[model samples]
Each structure stands twice: as structure tokens, then as C-alpha cells.
Target: MKIVATEGCHLIGKNGERWIDGMASWWSACHGYNHPHVREAVTAQLQRMPHVMFGGITHDPAERLASRLAEVAPDDLNHVFFSDSGSVAVEVAMKMAIGHWRRHDRPGRTRFLAFENAYHGDTTGAMSLCDPQRSMHARYSGAITQQFHVPLPRDETTETNLDRVLAEHSDSIAGVFVEPLVQGAGGMRFHDVNTLTRIRDACRRHDLLLIADEIATGFQRTGKMFAVDHTADLPSPVVPDILCLGKALTAGTMSMAVTIARSHVFDSFYSDDPGAALMHGPTFMANPL
Candidate 1:
């Protein structure tokens, strides 16, 4: 069925029949489709200008939106790096984690550890985190960079192996990637909150970064603004060192995503030497529209 139009959670078919949206339009239209507020915002933005380069200039909507995002996101996730898609955002997050360690004289900490049946995104770095056993990227196994993978969390065994792997790879591991309470693309798998606590504890004890790919489960999808919010009950209750958010951001009206980091991570790249800066940046990073 061809959809000619959409409004809220319904789509208008070619024959003019209305169909309820079952997939949230790939889980992007969290506010439904063609929402009035978003439509109005776009219309107002159109009157001013559709878009402007972000390399050296600033704009109103982008500033306001970034501030609003920082307000609602997990504590200290204040630094935002915009991108064109979730996959790219994940790639950037990985770079941020590795860069953070490298700037501190641990360049060998370039590896990551994810779980079985996990799915972060489709880009090369993101695909490295995806489950290869029955995934679409199985054929690319020998093509992309390889990372460490372990079984999904279940009991004490999961924590044990996770800690053991971190201990064994203590000098080489960069970060531990997780999708939090719900692993959306990995068959909608859900794990206990204690599992998240365990992962957080492990990352802390090992002095490694914890990156939560919230592209598929952010913005109240998992009954909280972000999946990392569920980690509030942990002993420390701190947010992930870094987070990647997309899909629901901007209510899905635009192709936008962001990689957010805490102050410490941002400070790592803070330097007088130009070469110490983050070398990666998207052209459309902070477009006004």
C-alpha cells in the first residue's frame, strides 16, 4: 500500500483509506506524523531560512534545541555533536570514547566490548557492534573492523565474564557498549535493571567508558526519557560517559542525530594545539532548520 499522506499516527493510503501507524514510522514519529507544532516550527523556520552552514556560525533554533536536549538528557550530557543519522552518531560516539582515552596516553584502548545479538547501527563502526551470527552484515564479517563480543546478560555468569574480559583486556579496551534496558534491534531483548548496574559498575571499576546507544530506545520509549535514566538506582547513579540519540529527536521531522558527552570527555579534547581537537565533524552539524 502506497501512503500519499500522513497525520499523527495514521497514514493516508493511495485509495484515501487511513491506516494506523504500527511501526511509529520506524520508531521515528514518536509524536505521530505531521504534527502541528513541528509543522509550525518548520513553517516559521522556512520564512526565515531553510538552512545555514554550521562550521563557524550559530543560529536560534539550533541553539534552543541543543539547550532543550541537554536539559532533558541524563546528567552532564551537555556537549552535543550533531550528525545526519543514528549510525553516524554511533560512529562519532566511538571516536569520542577512543579519543578520550588516547588524549590521556592510552591509545591502545581502541577496542570495544558489546553483547551477542546486539544491534547498534549499520555504519562500519556501528556494524562492528552488531550481532554477526544471523545479521545482515554477516557477509561483511571479514570486511569491517572486529571488536570483542560476549553473550547477552543472564545471571552471575554474565557479570563474571564481562568483568573477566575487561580485566584481561584492561590495557586495550576503550569502552563497553550497551543498548540499556532494551536492545531494540537485537530482537527486542530486555534485561533486568541490575544488569545495567553491573555494567556501570564494571566500567567504573575498570576505568572504561560506558556508551549507551539510545537511538532506538530514547525519549520516553522505555518509560523514561532515556534508557540510561533507569540506571538511577545504581550505587553511583551517574549517566553513561557518552550517548547517541536520534529518530525521536526533532520528532523525526528532519534527518538529525547527536553524540553527547560529559564534561570530562569534552575536556580531553580541550587544548591549545589545533591537532588535539576532534578531527571529525559533519558539514550539517548545527544547521538552523
Candidate 2:
């Protein structure tokens, strides 16, 4: 039951009744629909280039967008691995995390740890990390891998519980994926940034990569440029080894997402063997227009 829109935050249906959009079309219209600026940009791009497969080629729009994202993203997240949506971006982050350890001679550390009630995307890897209690896919248990889920603790026992979970399963954990401050789609559950810092420290201590799924918390949604900025005031700020971004990548104009990782993670794919080349990519891998 998708509604048709004729203007920003306004919709016209089959019955021709116009109404203000409160639902915002499943919450994807960040600037609403039919925004003037967005329309103008799309119009201009359409005039210049309508479409081109982003495989083994480059284009100005993608390059410029990547440059802008790099400038605004965290200090260390300079690289951008683009995808068409948030789900694929989450998959990319997971693949990078696993590949990192495999390249470093630690293939046994393949398990991932995610907070309970966390929601990254709908893909298999993303669904695996999400709490089944909140997901509709709970009935299809065998469809995805099981990930360690740490309960979101209250102020009194947050640190203690987190430490206990990490200690219990730290040996086989490859990475920890978190939603930073606010866990959107999980009832908008919010946690203190300090809790993220503590988890970050625990991951570091356990030699596990920290992956931040900031698809919903990025780009000033949390009153900061990124939720990670909120943790900067902590004794040890949490800087994830990999950052997943989407939703507002183009301010919601285009369906684009990215996974930014440290140089070492990218290095894993730099090998002579084609099998080790991260044999996964979309047809539009490097579209140019």
C-alpha cells in the first residue's frame, strides 16, 4: 500500500484526496518528497547523464559525493565502498570485518557480536545481528547465522553486563557491530555514548574489530554530525574500525550507501589470487555517468 506523492510531505492518492504525509513513506523521505533542491539536482543530473553502470568506471557525481562524505565523516574513515542500499552496505561491512581477520591469519575469529534490539538492515548478515525478538524473520531461524546478542543494560549494570558478555565469548569474536547511540527500528532505544566507549575498549582488549552501523545515526540526526562524536568526550572515544553509512548519503536524494574501513581491511583484497579478491560485487560496482 505505497502512496503516491505530488509534493514534499504531501500526497495525492487514487481517490485524488490530498493529505500531509506524517508517516513519510516508511520514514525514508528525510527532506520529504518533491523537494525543490532535490528535484533541481536530479533534473540537472538527468540532463547531463541519466544512467550508467558503475563497474570499472568513474563519474563526477560519485567522485564528488565521495569527496564530500570523506570531508564530513570521522577522521580515519577516508575510504568509501559504495552500494545501492543500506542492506548491501551492512553486508559489505560484515564481509570486510571477516576478511580482515582471515587475511591476518586469524580465520577462527569469524563470529560477530551485536547488541540486542539492534537493527542494521534486512540482509542475512544484518538480520543475524539483529535481535530475533524484534524481527519478523524469527520464524525462519535457519536462514541466517546466529550472532551473539548482548542485552542493552540499564545505567546500573551496563558496564558490568557488557564486560561479562565480552569475557565469555571474546575468544571467537571477529567484530562488534553497534548502532552507536540510538537503535532505530528497535523502538528508538537510546543508550549513553559512554556505553559505546566501554564496548569499544572491550573490543580493543579482545583484539576484535569495532564496526559502527551509523546508517540511521549519521549526518546530524543525533544533534551531532555523527553519534560517534557524542562519545568523544569519554575518557576513550570510540572510533570504529569500519563505519556503515546510508539513508542520508546524498541527503536521501539517491539510493546510495557506503562502507568505510581502515586501510588494513582494504589491503586484504589486494592479492594475486582472484579468489582472495573479495569475489563479491554488484553489477554497478563502479558506475560512471
Candidate 3:
């Protein structure tokens, strides 16, 4: 059925049928549909300026948002890269982690590590990080860049398996990327908190970056500001080196996504050489509205 409109938690179909939004518009419509606050804010933005090029320009809204996210996100994730969609956000994150090592003199560190039941996003780079066991992109297997996949961390040996993969990849892997806490498109798989801590420990021990795909688990979805919040109390102190967020940014009122990186990761791209800079930028990035 085609949705003609929405109010609160209900969607009105073209035929005038009212249906409760069970999926919350794929978990993006956290404030439900056509919310007054959302409408007002968007209307206010539309009045000011719908968009402007992110290249060679900056905007107030984007600045405020980046600041707010930096304040709320865990660890040293203070750098923000705005993108147009969730998939693209994951792509940016992949580049950020890969670039972090690449620019830091380990250019061969290109592959990423993901688990068997993980799901990051739909774009090719993002899809490459998605678990291939039952991926929707299985048909594209031959063409997609294959990433190292570890079995879902069900036991203490999960760390052992990760160490094995890292050892095998041996400096070729950019980092271990996972949809922390609840793996969303990967069947909503939820794991024990210890599992995440173990993963964090393994990354730290192996000196690899940790990329947390918080696109679906962010914005208080998992009862905390982000799923990573659940890992704060872990025995080993750690946080994601890079975090990807979307779906609920602007309360899902607009198509917006962000890749947040720690100062360490961001600093790697800071160099006197022009070639050392991160060159990825979407036209709609950091749009004013």
C-alpha cells in the first residue's frame, strides 16, 4: 500500500486506510510521522535555506549538529562527516578508518573485519562489510570486495577468533566494524555486553581501529543514547574509534547521516601535503538546512 500521509504513530494509505507504524518507518521515524516539532524545525530550515554546497562552505545548522553529536558521542569521536544517507555514511566511515591507517603510513591496511551476523549498509563499500552468511547481496558476491568475517562472538574464544583474523590479515585490515549491541539488518541479533568488550579488547590488543555502525542503534534506540553506551561499564575501558550514525538524525525529518571519528583518526589526515587530506565530500554534505 502507498502511504499518502502520517500522523503520530499511524500512517494513512492512499485508500484512506489507517495503519499503525510498527517499524517506525524502518526505525528512522522515532518521533512518529508528521510530528509538529519535526515539521516546524524543517519548515524553519526550508525558510532559511534548504541546502548549500558543503565544499568551500560551512553552515550554522551543520555546525550546531556536529557540536551536539560530539558532545553526546562516547570516547574521542569529535570529528564529524555529514553525508546524505545511511549507506553513504557507512561508506564514509569505511574510508575514514581505511584512510586513518593509509595516511598514517600503513597504506596497505585496506581490508575490514566484520562478523557473521553483521549488517552495516547497502552501498558497495558498506555491503562489503556486511556479513556474507545470509546477505541480501549474495548474488553480487563475485563482484563485491570480500571482507574478513568472524563468527558471531558467542564465547570467550570470540576474541581468539578475532585475533586469528587480525593475525591472518596482519596489518592489511583497517579495523573491525560491527553494529554494536544489536545488529540491525543482520536479523536484529543481540549479544551479551561482554562480547562487545571482548571485541574492543581484541581491537586494542591488535592495534586495529574499532568502527561501530551505530546507524540503527543510535539516538536512544537501545535504551541508551547509543548502543556503545552499554559498553562503557566494561571491565576494559574502550570506545569505538569511529562511529557511524543515521536514521533519526533530524529525527528522520530529513535525509542525513554522519561518520564520527576520534581526533586521532581525524588527525592522520592532517598533513602539510595536499594529498594527505581526506578528499571525500558529497555536494549535500553539511547543508545548512
Please, what is the TM-score per model? 0.96, 0.89, 0.96
User: Considering lDDT, which of the candidate structures 2 and 3 is the better prediction for this target?
Assistant: 3
True-vs-predicted CA distance for residue 69, candidate 1, Å? 1.7
Best by TM-score: 3
Model 1 per-residue lDDT tens digits across residues 133-213: 756777899788888888755678888998899999989999999888887877788987778878888899899999988
Clashing pairs in 2: 53-287, 54-286, 54-287, 55-286
* Residue-by-residue lDDT tens digits, candidate 3, 1-289: 8888889999999988999988898899998888888788888989989988888778889899999999998867899999988899989878888888877788899889899877888889988887776878777776889999987666867677777878888679889887877877878778877778788877887889988888888999999999889867766555889898999886767688999999899898888998878888887887666
lDDT of each: 0.86, 0.78, 0.84
Q: What lDDT does candidate 3 reach at residue 161?
A: 76
Clashes of each: 0, 4, 0
Best-matching candidate per lDDT: 1
Q: Which residues of candidate 1, in runs, are more than 4 Å off?
A: none
Residue 52 lDDT in candidate 2: 81
